[model samples]
Target: MLNGLTDAGSYLQGVSTLQNRTVILSLNGNYMAAGDSYYDGLAALGICYEDYQKGGAWIFENGVPTLYLSGKEYSQKYPIKDGEIYVKSELHNEDCEDTELILNGKNYSFVENGLNILIYDQDTKQVIDHAGTDIYVSFEMIREEKGE
Candidate 1:
């Protein structure tokens, strides 16, 4: 049985098969592949990869389609789950509608956009909230400028 983090290539292979995983790439828009420089630090853990995501999009990576950010602001909300909820999202640039963000949604849409991630376990109640690259964290954030 593969206990705690057997290796990096193994994890990537597993992620390729995961149904609910997200990469939020910024590649040339591969069928837009992508990557980030921060991941190189994983070498110390003995987990590494040959290629990495370097694009900007929240699309289905395993399939044959690409995704990109648009000029549309979005505002939606969801009640906290038992006063404890874990949400994860990846974003590179805020090309999402070049307009003034009105105060709305379960979160502050206009808040300073930065590298963010979160994960919580129901049983252990372990919370890992990260704003930047956390080797113990599994994520990659990318950005693409307009008129590139």
Candidate 2:
């Protein structure tokens, strides 16, 4: 009887395949996959990758990715490249204000002077200013004028 019990235990342990071990490990937060059942639970709490593309912006609550533009979910995962421009909007006085911007994984700055707003390029450090008047300047335009 003792030998039979030992054999049963060994068999059960042998039946624990790598996939089963992985599933168990994932359940314990030791592993993670994109579409795993356990990952879905984490995603519900915003604990997934909130990646964006060259011209994309998103917000990550926990780890999930939420697009900043449309509030629609992304069907695929992406990474934000260097010098990527991301347009976002802000609401002031119950009115929506849209702005074109980019972040180089460094600093964040906003320039607003009277009716003019400026967006700075992280790479060239150039400024693009937009005035309520029909006058607007791209960062490249400013750099070209300055011979930078």
Best candidate, lDDT: 1
Give the alpha-carbon lDDT of every model.
Answer: 0.26, 0.25
Worst 10 residues of 2 by lDDT: 20-29
What is the alpha-carbon lDDT for the whole of candidate 2? 0.25
Per residue, candidate 2 scores C-alpha lDDT tens digits across 1-148 of 1112122123222222112110100111111222232223333333334421111223332123333333211122223324443344333432223333334342221322101112333334443221111112221111112322
The local distance difference test score of model 1 is 0.26
What is the per-residue lDDT of model 1 for residues 1-148, given as tens digits with 9 covering 90 to 100? 1123234334333333433222222112111112343344322222234332322222222322233333122222222324422122333454322212111122211213222222222334333121222223333322122232
Q: What are the runs in model 2 whose C-alpha is more than 4 Å off?
A: 1-78, 94-100, 105-148
User: Which number leads on TM-score?
Assistant: 1
lDDT of 1 at 139: 38
Residue 108's lDDT within candidate 2 is: 27
